[model samples]
Target: MELILALAIGVLFSSGIWLILRPRSFQVITGFMLLSYAVNLFIFITGKIHINKAPLTLDGVPVDPTRYADPLPQGLVLTAIVIGFATTALYLVVLLGSRGLTGTDHVDGKERDHDE
Candidate 1:
C-alpha cells in the first residue's frame, strides 16, 4: 500500500510540474491544484495508517503510540484542502479577468507563434 501510494504521489507531482511549465494559464492552475493534492496526500501519509484505532485515548488509559491515530496530520490536511480550494477559486477569477481584458489565456498575455 505504501509503495502504491508513493508511486501515485510521484506521478501526480511529475504531471503537475509538467503542466506548470506549460504556457496556458488554465493548465498552470490545474498544475497548482494537482500539486496541492500531492502535498495533502503526503501530509496524511505522514500521520501513519492505523486500522481500527481511536484518534485519542482516555485520561486513565495507558497511551500507546501504535494504537492511536495521530490527529494532527488529519487536521492539517483538512485545513490545506480548504485553503487550496479558496486559492484555486481566486486563481480562476483572476484568470477570467485577465482573459477578458487581454483576450488571451496564455500566461504571457499573447498567443505564442507556433510557426517559428
Candidate 2:
C-alpha cells in the first residue's frame, strides 16, 4: 500500500510539474492543483497509516505515542485542501476574465502563429 501510494504521489507531482511548464494558462492552473494534492498526500503519509485507532489519548495512563497516528498532518492537509480550493476558484475567475479580455488562453495573452 505504501509503495502504491508513493508511486501515485510521484506521478501526480511529476505530471503537475510537466503541466506547469506548458504555455497554456488553464494547464498551469491544473498543474498547481495537482501539485497541491501531491504535497497534501505526502504530508499525510508522513503521519503513517493506521486504522481503528484513536487520534488522541483520553486516559491518564501512560500510552505509546507511536500507537496513535499523528493528527498534525491530517489537520494540515485539511487546511491545505480548503485553501487550495479557494485559490483554484480565484484562479478560474481570473482566467475567465483574462480570456474574455484577451480572447486567448495562452499564458502570454496572444495566439500562436501556426504558419511557422
Candidate 3:
C-alpha cells in the first residue's frame, strides 16, 4: 500500500509540474491543485501507515507510540486541504478576470498564432 501511494504521489507531482509549465491559465490552476493533493498525500504518509489503530489511547491505558496513529499529520492535512480549496477558488476568480480583460487564457495574455 505504501508503495502504491508513493508511486501515486510521484505521478501526481510529475503531472502537476508538467501542467504548470504549460501556457494556459486553467492548466496552471489545475497543476496547482494537483500539487496540493500530492503535498497532502505526502503529509499523510509521514504520519505512518497503521491499520486498525486508534488515534487516541483509552483512559488508564499505557501510552504506546505504536498503538495509536499520530493525529498531528491528519489535522495538518485537513487544514491544508481547506486552504488549498480557498486558494484554488481565488485562482479561478483571478483567471476569469484575467481572461475577461486580456481576451485570452494563455499565461502571456495573448493568443499564439498557429503560423508562428
What's the lDDT for all of these models? Answer: 0.91, 0.90, 0.94
- Which of the two candidates, 1 or 2, achieves a greater lDDT against the reference? 1
lDDT of each residue in 1-116, candidate 1, tens digit only: 89988998999999999999998999999999999999999998998866778887879998888788998998999999999999999999999999999999999889878824
Q: In candidate 3, where is summed lDDT lowest over 10 consecutive residues?
A: 107-116
Index of the highest-lDDT prediction: 3
lDDT of 2 by residue, 1-116 (tens): 89999999999999999999998999999999999999999988888877776678778858888677788989999998999899999999998999999999998888788823
Off by over 4 Å in 3: 59-62, 113-116
* C-alpha RMSD of candidate 2: 2.1
**Pairs of colliding residues, candidate 2:** none
* Model 3 Cα lDDT, one tens digit per residue, 1-116: 99999999999999999999999999999999999999999999899987888887799998988889998899999999999999999999999999999999998888888825
Is candidate 1 or 2 superior in TM-score? Answer: 1
Error of 1 at 75 (Å): 0.7
The whole-model C-alpha lDDT of candidate 1 against the native structure comes to 0.91
lDDT of 2: 0.90
Output the number of the TM-score-best candidate.
3
